[model samples]
Target: MFWGDLHVHTAYSLDAYGFGTLRTPAEAYRFAKGDAVGSPAGDVQLDRPLDFMAVTDHAEWLDLMYTCTDPRMSAHPYCVKLRNQSTQETGGTVFRDFVNPTITQAQPAKADVCTDDPSACDDALLSQWERMQQQTNAANDPCTFTALNGFEWSATPNYSHTHRNIIFAGDNVTPTPVDYIRFPEIDQLYSQLEAGCRAEDGCDAITIAHNMNMGDGKSFDVETESERTLALRTRYERLVEITQEKGTSECLPDYTHRESLGECGYETYITSHSRQKPLADFEEEEWERMRSSYARGLLRRGLLTYANRQDAEGNPLQVGFIGSTDSHTGLGGYVEEDQWQGTVFGIGNFERNMSRMGFNPGGLVAVWAEQNTREGIFSALKNRETYATSGPRIALRFDAAKVGEVPACKAGGALAPIAGGTPMGSTLPEASKAAVFRIAVTGDKAPLEKIEIIKGTLKGESYEESVIPVWQSDKGEANACVIWSDTEFEPAAPTYWYARVTEVPTPRWSSYICQEAGRCEEFPDADVKIQEHAWASPIWHLPTR
Candidate 1:
């Protein structure tokens, strides 16, 4: 398996530039290639070179920053104002007043810069996009380091985080990125992608939804838009980012009946950019936020949707899980806690301090692929053969099949008795007697704590889940493996199973911050430590016909 980070931002993104990252796409690719790069905090480099990386800067302001700074654009008055405001030391003033409003209100800036004849601005945007593609082409080294041409569709409607990173398969990409300004709704974005990329012969793209935790209740809404059918959604959106700098989108303790599961609350930050109320303080209406925003809840919804009606087009509502750094400082796969850098740069020490306290080192996406090239990695992602890790380079595999069939299982591969059985991101075949699930995990930095098989089934109209401890280690073993059979498996109800492997307790980013600030004893809340973990994509068992 090869590890890579699919979502990262560079200075071309207005917010990233305002926050202090001055690195271009070339510089970001250079940094991911194991070269030293300078950030606002200091010079930084990845501990190791990533197999693949994508510089997915925000599409909203794809070339706005460069347009403002270019002296040749002095004829545009608003460009001068933007350039001047960006240099202000007020810390995110430009973003707060100008950019954030555009996203939150779904109102594009109609200033003279591009309001009347948008062609000039569109030309500049195309130029920037070409530059980014050129950088990617220059940086890509087949079988060594892969540079993916991608961009973030910043669709923060009403300040609700409905963001997605659009990654293309190869160099044959759209001339320009599809931004949320022109395509505000997620469905519209998908339609644009299909029309632009999928319609092409060799070009294709996949949209991975991220930061669903801050989506109010709209991120995983089962209600289809006028244009977005279930088939279209399943066809385009193949993966969901379960963990990132914002927090883990896996599950919340308060949201589920399985509150006893100790690991459900790892690095949860739903209250960060939202109403700022803690999960314990959530009101009755507020509780619905977690239900729609979490990955587990979304998976349950997927099962319920699939059970109600099988996709006529054969595109089921299964979405795999992956983790990304979501690092705005142009750092990809830089998730080491001790070597952490703030996400934004121009912010004062106060914001930087808060970043260190609240933010994590970020997460990584692992792909079971044949090589390190773009084709190899993109194919693995397309097939949903992927796993997510909370910083550590943990290795994990989950598979299930009948007792007699060969154990030809891999994450996201399907196995059905009628068809064989199902792997992660697939619907399982009907079982006669029982089904055997095999799970294996190997830790990187810390020893293994335990391995759990999390099963979620739709009970009536609601969802019921259980975290079954398949394997445990008392002595902190470096590896844990298990093969268990569900003899009491019910073929009447649809079910899904995924493995969660946890490492021994280690100091969190918050703990390191507190210790360095000399307040480890005083601030108990800041001294939080956690067991880093990885989550395998789920394998599903459809109801036996």
Candidate 2:
């Protein structure tokens, strides 16, 4: 099993400065090492060392927001406007509100800066960005610690659209990172990378979309500008961060009442901070507006719907799942209570220090790979044989096949199939004699409770769902190997499969800290807050053959 964090920020990111302490790439790596044990901002640290880590900071302007605005990088239209906006009394507040929850009202206000000459931006920022990319690649160390070349493209349409983080598997690539500032729209950016990769040898990349819930529901909109046809969910966008520091982007408590209680009540990504309003009071309905949009996106177009839509080519597109901490702090794998590093300094802190804190401990990206190495881990991630936890090195594997399933440990014959064959995101050509589903979930000494497969399928034009609780380590509440076998299938169901693992109880970081510190009131709600240990695979959607 390999452990890492795919979503991380460094001083190179434009927004990391106002919140974090670490600035340089080497400093970020050291910070991760220190934060792996703990930090002052809050609970952050990994119980174990990571096999790999990707320092994925925002690509737009690359670190120019903090640097170009230095007045040293030369005065450009965007930089000048950014400097002006940064100085505004309401600037930070407005920017923070647009983090994950609400639409950014700031862009429209800044529209005037780029209105006259958009190409003016092209000439001004390119050199500084190239230098930053040079620095990022120079910091890569596959021998000492695995470094993933990656960047976050801040592409949000109306505060709601697919916001993706692109990561490369190897160090040798060409050109530099291209974020929203350069290309603005995702489709255009996608076209650019695809063209570049096809033209070059040994050039490959993957994009992971995160915080879809915050995107006013447009993140998963299957359609392009023309609503007549569904957009293409590319194989390039293989993974989605279902959970993050902003809050779990998996499911909402209110909307997903019947399925499972989601982490919805937590502080939202967007608030009216820029408008002189405190971050304390939250409007539930306003939050629901965003959540409702997300649910609607899922319903109107099934998970990864854009992927398989009929195109000129008969090949289908596929998408997968992973979780990450959008921690502005440079530290990665920080999720322990005693060691939590604020996701956003002063903002992520649940306990008020001076003001609102955006800091949540850094998170980890988990993969079940053959070995703990760069190529091994990268291969696992690209193949979608991976899962993510807020922070923990949990090993989980799920498989669906023609014959009934068997454990990798108990299957006895060979574990080679687990490697050669696709486990999670890859699909079977057609339904077989008997569909065997197998899941092996292990926690970091945390007692296992349940493991189940949540499945959704398309029936004709309408979609239907089913939950198969195939394994439960606790039978009537005792430790046992909880496993199940299902041979029956609704012949016509266009099925997709993924697995989830739960702890015996819950392990909310805040609750654990309060117990050790003997401070309950200092916390919010304990009973409602239990740290869950789980992993989800990419949905292997088997559309009707």
Candidate 3:
């Protein structure tokens, strides 16, 4: 299996640049290639090189950032104001100019800079887009490192995050990004992608939704989606980001019945840009927000929606899970807790030094690929053969099959799906009443304590969710393999199951930084312990039609 980070930003992203990020796409790709890069503290390098990555800079202000940095046009008065005191030391005046337009507007348009010369905006955007492609292609090495490129369509209307990364399969890509300003809605984005990326044109792409925990109960807005849009969502979006610097999108403790020990409430972060109140502040809408803002809830909702209706498509929200650093400074796959730095250079640095500790070293995406080439990695991603980890190189494999139909795990020493059985992110046998699931894992730098089988089985209109312990050990086992049977499984119910493997409790990224700063007591909320874990894509058993 190959490990990579698919969501990282360079200075080209407007907010990242406003936060005084200096690393560019080239530097980000080289950093993933195992080169040391300059940072605020000093030179920083990854402990290990990544097999693949995508530089997903925000598409909103590429033209403006490019205009401000260009030697020719940068002398303009508007560009001058944008560059003045843009770093964290000064103020967020210009930053506010760029960000407010995004979250405040129902359909965010170009900033004040766009009004000056709209054509120039297009020219600069194309220039920066080509620059990203060239720089990424320059660093791509087949069978060693795959440098995929993409742009983040940052939609933050009403302080809610509906962000999606538009990553290309190969060098052939759209001439320009379909951003929020021109094409604001998800339907518009999908239509443009389908129109742009045609098989005959040597183009292919996929969109991965991130920060659904920040989606404010509307990320996978199934309540109002049409059948066509749901189909489009299934076609365009295959994977969702399970964890990142901001926090984990797996579940919230109160939102999920399976999570009771507060383990579900891990690493929740609210960015400084949001004006919305905390999750606890909203009384009536809080439960709805919790339900829609999590992966487990969204998956269950998708299953139930399909189970009840024939008008909608077949489980349109059936998707895989992956993790990425979401690093704004080009530090792709730099997820080590001990060597942690902030994702956004200025804010993370300022917050860490002050011991505020909201952000964290994010997670990683591991792929089961045939080779290290772009084709292999992209194929694995398209097939949903991936797992996500919270900053560890933990290895995990999950597969489900009927009583005696499961194949051996010795297929090249790894598990593979066979007839009457399915791997993670797939549907099980059509008529099987129950199945046996295999959970295999190996920890890194820590030992496994528990392996949880989180399940949601349809019980009437809603689902009965539970987090059952499949295996446990107190002696800190480094490896685990368990075969668990779903004896209560019903063939008629719409059900989904996934594995959550947790290591023994360890110091969080904040704990390490706060302890070193000697302000652990002063920053009591920041200093805490957490169980770093991995989430496998779910195996589904939808109601038989």
Candidate of highest lDDT? 3
Error of 1 at 371 (Å): 1.5
Per-residue lDDT for 270-322 in model 2, tens only? 42222222323435654455553332234324433423454412122345567
> Tens-digit lDDT track for model 3 on 1-47?
89999999887876777767878898899999999878875788887
Question: Using TM-score as the measure, which candidate wins?
Answer: 3
Q: Give the CA lDDT, 0 to 100, for residue 343 in model 3.
A: 53
Q: Cα lDDT for residue 294, model 3?
A: 74
lDDT of 1 by residue, 385-421 (tens): 8889988988887777654764533332332222354
For all candidates in order, the CA lDDT equals 0.74, 0.54, 0.78
Residue runs of model 1 more than 4 Å from their true location after superposition: 70-77, 84-89, 225-228, 254-262, 311-316, 345-351, 402-422, 430-433, 459-462, 517-524, 543-545
TM-scores vs. true structure, each candidate: 0.90, 0.77, 0.93
**Over 4 Å off, model 2:** 20-22, 33-47, 69-128, 172-174, 224-232, 253-309, 312-317, 347-362, 371-374, 401-422, 473-483, 512-519, 526-528, 539-545
Q: Model 3: residues >4 Å from true position, as ranges?
A: 71-73, 106-116, 254-261, 270-279, 345-356, 406-420
Which pairs of residues collide in model 1? 19-345, 19-346, 412-424, 415-420, 415-421, 415-422, 416-420, 416-421, 417-420
Candidate 3 has its poorest 10 consecutive residues by lDDT at: 409-418
Cα RMSD for candidates in order? 3.8, 5.7, 2.8
- Cα displacement (angstroms), candidate 3, residue 487, comes to 0.5
